[model samples]
Target: MSSRERVLAAVAGIAAVAAAVAAPGAAATGRHQDWDETAYRGQIEVVRSDDGPSDPTVLNGTVFVDRDRDSRHDRNERGVAGVEVSNGREVVTTDRRGRYRLPVYDNMTVFVTQPAGYQVPVDEFNVAQFHYNHLPAGSPELRYGGISPTGPIPDAVNFPLVESSLTDDRRLSCIIAGDLQTYNLTEVEYARKGAIADLARRNDYQGCGSLFVGDVVGDDLSLYDEVKGLSAQTNGPARFLPGNHDLDFDATTAVHSFDTFRAQLAPAYFSYDVGEAHIIALNTVRYPCTPDLDNVDGLRPGCNDPVNRPRYNGHIDETQMEWLRRDLAKVDRDKLIVIAGHIGLLNWADEGSAIHQVDQVREVYELLHGRKAVALAGHSHSIENMRTGDAMQGWRDLFGIDSLPFPHITVGAIAGDWFSGRVTEDGYPTAIQRDGGRPGVLTLDLADSSFQERFTVTGENDRVQTQLGLNTPTYREWYVARSAWNSNPVGAAPELGDPLVVDQADLAGGTWLTTNFFIGGTGSTVTVRLNNHRPRQAVRTQPMRGEDQFVGPEWSDPAAVAEQLVHGGSVANRTMHLWRFELPTDLAPGTHQAHVTATDVHGRRFADTLTFQVVAQR
Candidate 1:
């Protein structure tokens, strides 16, 4: 077993007692099965005012350290000083007495930034309760139960925090999961068996916790309760960021678009501190976006028009931008800023599209000018570990970004390809991503300010990182035919006959060993060696050097496409992780084994092998 595995095994004893403690309100849901006892019951204490709407301008709160596992601020309890509090726009730190006062608005979420060395109380569903939503007039008629009428301004919204050694430790394992877009209860079950179960099995992530970067459910927001049941099973506190799909479609304006998401999951955007990492989770998807605020003209020109209809755009509003500026000011310069959002700042899959990329890309780059930071995002189902200086044309045209200022990683989705494709024996779908990556969760193993990233494929260990296949002229032809058939349901699906057997014509034309190295990017390298021969450096398919997307059948990953096209899901047409090593047109026509090794920018290496047969003639 690995050293990390050993540490995780040893953690069970220390955590067993905590796991035995049942959450106070878990029975209310009647759904917390595997981790009912482990569920956290504590929640935010919203104290109402006797003055009603007379004194609704200002709000006051105390962040108290909750001992005895109760969600109340007793007279004997002490207050946690230096914790930052925000009314969404303005940020303020707690005074020496741990008391804070902020100007209030009717429709705003008042939350506390979870400071290091302490933990905010979580609900029965393991959702951290650090915020109080105050909406005086309720929501403007919505489907999925938007916030209930929060009558008047509260006298105090005391935030209850508990002392936790798990969050205080310098050794942190932060799990970044993307797009658990469960449209129905069945899809929710798939997520439970897949990534949720994977998290429950691991005990090492208690400190930094798990942050799901949006699309908690599909369009139907009613499934939030079912998804939260899955969240209760996780070993760490669950945090979520809203995505485009998580928006309230009935809402007419951008401000109220995520009302239901905020009520169900968390604040639209928030920040938390764990060890030396200052994690900023931003809500980048703006629903009912206007043409002007989209920044890039013509990109989303159909905002308020009857013809095109207003849709969600990749943007950060003025209010959020202001909050981010203030939030970064409080963070220490030495701390690693983990910037996470739904739609990424820039990505390889959507490198040319404005809708998939963020509009405030340049300003965000300026915000973290010299600070040590890494951007994490979802939206794009593909896994990308982009390094600094990696450039793409879509980013240049839409946002005028020449190269990445820091490492911007697009964490692969939990519900891979919308949970499409055939069901595997393990009770999950074979949802291969668009860039040919399998469904998985990302982990950042942090020691102080520095970190190393690792991707864990669903139902597989860390060692199983890359997928191996052979791309030949014959396979390319089949890919083209099958792709055309997928566009329109006509004729029988084309078959890729004997992908391992490359005939004389294939060897003469071209045949190459392909490695779909998930999370591999610029600075990363892949090499191939056949039967004791010297390793040949395989060329990366996409250079990520300011160019349009390199797509087609030749660039497609045959291994991933085989499952996607035949069953269901997006075709693995273009990818940044694919590396090709052309085979030599030599004489030997027999069974051959090719060894493949992928080395990331951090120098961590993963190995995979593929065996194929070479025939004399077709």
Candidate 2:
């Protein structure tokens, strides 16, 4: 090629990189879509060799500062003491010399818990590399090709760290994303335009970064790279937790269930300290669950064997449990403990499901009895902000638990009901959730131990929080007359026309102004004002006081069901976050405006308005 052609080609390449980078994030967000191959990325420097004599009994490592950012511990690089290292079982801190040793196992992951003051290294995709997966015997024959054999334990598994002021401050903004369960490449691009684009546009959350709480893919591990590529376009480092979908079904035993996950992402269960919060990401899913796994006696039969039909139970294995205990033992008593997992310890969406709720829920609560803590999870594909003292009959009947001891928030999914809905202008499905929440990401804004969580809906700004609609007798009748959605959606059903329009018979039959507060819980309140009249308080449907879940059309969100019925998705027949205000019986017939203001547990208020017509007759 001539010099002129070379210059033009270089300019075109630069423009392509610029366009891809600028398309995702806002200006100065400091995120990029593509990364230079040879540029030095901050990552845990693993200086190991296979040709040397190895010690399979124990592993040793040094946590040192990589001054040159070459992911290497040269002579000039000094040791950083007090860094905690774990072998997935025991937690030990480095000595003054920054050297520590631990007993090794065949299927253990050795990772350095990123300390608050220093930043760890990252890969090209900006995935923090803090752990080393040690699978000496590799894995059993599985479809995803679980962790390859590491041959032998290396001489040293040193971890590299670079000093940064990112986590040095007390105020922390951590993004908790959920269930990027992309089944195929098409769905993958859908995720890119949805929450991923939302994350890329923000520059905050550098302290704790983004913690994806499970269901990274929909049973296909090959999509791991695609999902990782999505993270590359984001601002902060990306961390992942394993869900039921992120498992190797071919693994007969639970030991190697997440070997491929460990090989691809970080450890299945790990902990990190960012600013004032100590984040503990737990592996709460037990694949091929056994009745023996449940201490609460909640799991059913036919879950013992995987070859026949593999079932998963929400229970943490003894290994991870012990590791959690050891890891938490190192944290300070007053610091905020953010316990994150795939299956929630207990949630409103799956309150009654023995297989969906954690068996050792009480055990986990007991462990953090006197600590300032909160829990975040995903997998139910619903948004639930369950606070302390919030009670559910299902939690009582299944786990014998009366009420929540701490705040347990179920962060909703990116793949809203498996991406089931009509295509949007953004080139993705509307993908409304089973609980009537739009696809979004959860952000925990913290100052010291105090925190206030806010959910940002996809393809919209943070101000969009509540969904207002009218639930009339007409909607109930239509809901009952709707097709058998379980099978192929076959059957003609008439739309409710205008959901806000209620006839005199409907008002007499009890019409209600429903507000589906996506993140509302026990302490939340929804107030409604009809035609700017006196505001009336809305009552929560579930009550969340150990009451059994109310299902069918009465407790449903008509607006969500309207979309779910026509677009093909999980029907929103039941949810704990719904609030209803009854309409006056002697209401004047005409169009009227209803003003809605929803106040969350933190006393944060969101206001919206809806215009509905009241006809004399249908």
Candidate 3:
């Protein structure tokens, strides 16, 4: 069968399974029993009083050295001084007694900025318990049970820490996974075999550990346990940040929106230090979204207009900005700052959107002035490595970012394309991404303050960097035909005619070799050599500087499209890292090998080889 027919057949075969798995009743029992409809049933407008006591509420906390490794401050435990703490807005250091007092308000999360040479106590699920949520009245009535009102402010809320050698070394490796987003148990299995299994076999990241960049589950707060179980399989501590999907949609107020998440995971946003890197996890998602015509969800009459209903948007509130300013002021300017969040500060996939990109990117840039910095995000499922000086007109016009100050990467998802496509022998889904990239996790290997990033494709090694294909008229015809077939119901299966066999007519018509470098970016290079000939540079298909997106076969990676179009997933439309080179028409017909080498912006290189037959005619 042709590619389109295969995709349709696959969909038809799984239609009943999808229906049974997605049935409303299926989600109402077992792990999903706690998923209340009130949380997402209707909208409720949240109002708060601006008025407060004239006197600041002094909340005291002790950062004690847990000699016993327990998460409690025993009578014999000694306080460790000089550690920094925050009440989500103001930053203060512990006194000589390792005691800190910060003004607290209702709905404030006071957390310690984990210091190097010390480890914060982890909960049973390995979630760091360094923060104390001080919501006096707890969360308002909603589903997914938000924070229970902590009644009144306590006199003391102490955090326990133990000395550790994990973060004392100069070398650090961190695993960054994006969007586990398992809507059901089957998808969870896909994750176990995919990135989680890869992480379990590795011993590299003992200090920095793994940070899942949001979307831990698909709105079902009950699934947090299953997700946590998956994290337990990893070799190191697993940290999580909240995504738009992690929100308690029935929340009536912004303060209580992420209560369930904070309770199950870590605080909404926090910071820590390991070696020379200071990691800042920010809560960049703003919910109960104010009405915006630019909202990507396409909600009727906008988010704020229809009041009471909660909608999410990518924005950094003033309080978080204040916290960031205070947090960075205490850090050494020479240390590398790694800022991570759910939604990206800026991305190429949603180039024309303000909702996907942070609203205060310029302000964020100014805050990190004179410091070495890099950002990691994952709301867009595509893989993007945006180097400094990479400029897109949309980013410039929307966020006033003339050029990237540092690398801003969108890590590919662990649940690639939401775990779609056929299952593989490895017990995972072949969920190819919208950009035609495979599922993977990104690793930031750090030596002191400097670092380099590499993407490890799930079930594959680091060497599998580039995908090769031939961009000929036959492939282009198949592309158009397949696109039309997937969109309409009556079209026949898309046949590529013969992708492997290239004719003299194809060579005469100027067919080219295509390379899809998964982690490649601007300043990167791709070179191709055929039959031991001299190496030739392959030009990038789309230059990221101020241009509209170039899509279609001429701009796509044929190797990826070949699998994605046939397997039932997103088509590889446009990629910033794709490169192409024209093939010679004078060569004699024979089987040939093309050796491809790809070098990233940091001078790291990966190599792969592709073999194809050259024939005069079919």
Candidate 4:
């Protein structure tokens, strides 16, 4: 018998909707009964109304065939039939041609659960190609996220079949890339030259996949196809989400703000499993500008009326929130939960900035409780690993500052600063910020319930870049004041480069600049020696922002500042203008640090340092 007839004959005795509920731990919805019900009268139709043949020879419908047996299309797959088909709310089967259709709406997903015995095609990299796009004419110019607006859907949503398997434990791995907001092709090239090259060389990822959190291209949706081509550089499947710059300017409503994104990228809010973690990528940019949108305290309408709306801000709306709840429900409690988005939660690096806030971060955080969770995000073009234990533990700590609760890492941009300025040896901007983070991508290895984070610098060195000394309260006031006048005071750092000659007078009473370096390596020992030391003094405060005022454990001088001022608190404006250190020779074969001070071109002084290190074994 023919494939269609064979399939029908095989299930002809079966009911139209199988009564078998999916087994626990299976998570996947099983067979639909409609496959054998040839007597049923509901028709499967394809309606394409453009200036084409009245009787177009082909009916194009996007199909997502079940490949991994996970009941969801992971990547690279288009749906097909010989498989059971359903709209979730309705049931149907593919025609004798292995194609089927039920009523499709602007936002509906026409899916096919992978049949028990067929394989879905995969690319050269082994990534699954399992989902097809079904966009009929008269559908809104932009109806769903990632739909290509440049052309209409083709004649037929075809599925290239391979072999099939029933085993679901494929050791899935999804590559998570931070921001790549390339405003132009040049920036895209920068990304290609940098970590994109690195990704191309990697194939060990579980699921052998990659998902870019957001800012795929700097405010330009037109560059997506080129970005996709760059993604082909990788050895696995790739997916993407919408960032602030990916907004749909032509969208008539806020609901459609991510339309172009959906057409070109993956769903704005979707989930897939890799290893033991359920990774969900979200679109935090709620567009369709709203008037009362100046980083307000409680705003919910930002995602509803993006057009004619006031200012655009960052947030997760009710629709997405409800979806998140449903998505999380499907995940097992024992699995690690990883939530990746373009905007970070509680990012102090861009403190006081509204555009980078996740209006509903706390709500999402609550949903993933009791499960091992890590929130990975980007938008600031910087990398920070923040943790809170006490207050951040929620009501237990009253949301006050305590120990880090969980790690919240903000990944540096793949297209650092929109591929800022001149290109370096790597064909991209040396885009190393004075704050110490070099432009790069972050690699997270998750196994079971644990993960390790690695920041891969763009160029050859894989330098472990980090910020050294931030302004103490005294210096903070100075930097703040000078920064108001000089847009780049941080660049004009004071040059206290020379080693200090500790003398009796210097020891009597003096305050020194402290350096806080991040991304240090193993076996690294930070050592210090004064050219002279009548008083052996070194107080290295913990390396942190907004709180680097004290010296190391070696120093215990409370009056250093007061004595130096010759007047108590009156010297509030007095900043720490002098200090220095050298990179320890014993640092492990990785990144290291050396905090120092310096005087600017003018008489004014500023405190800053360096974040450098020895290379580690690849």
lDDT of 2 by residue, 237-259 (tens): 78999999999988887898998
lDDT of 3 by residue, 1-618 (tens): 653354344334333333343221101123111111101111111112345323348877788887765456778988889899998989999998898889878778888888988777654444556777778777777677778776666657787777767676687788889999988867877887667767655657766778899998988887777787676555455788999999988876566678999877888988999999999998888776765533544522345642555567787888899999999999999899999999999988887777788877889999997899999999889899999888888887776677799999999999989888889998998998888788989988889999998888887777788888898888888888888887884856877865777988888887889888999999999999988899999999878887767877788888878888888888887887788988898867999888899999889888888888888886
Which rank order by lDDT, best down to worst?
1, 2, 3, 4
> How high a TM-score does candidate 4 get?
0.60
Between prediction 1 and prediction 4, which has the larger TM-score?
Answer: 1
TM-score winner, 2 or 3: 2
**What are the C-alpha RMSDs, in order, of all predicted structures?**
6.6, 4.4, 10.0, 15.7
TM-score of model 3 relative to the true fold?
A: 0.88
Report clash pairs, candidate 1.
none
RMSD score of candidate 4 (Å) = 15.7
Alpha carbon lDDT at 526, candidate 1: 97
Question: Which pairs, if any, clash in model 3?
Answer: 39-250, 43-308, 43-309, 44-308, 137-149, 138-149, 291-304
lDDT of 4 by residue, 128-236 (tens): 4444444443235642344543234333444334332221233333466778787876666677667776665444442325678788876677776667656655544
Please estimate how well model 2 matches the true structure, expressed as its whole-model Cα lDDT.
0.83
Query: In model 3, where is the ten-residue run with the lowest total lDDT?
Result: 35-44
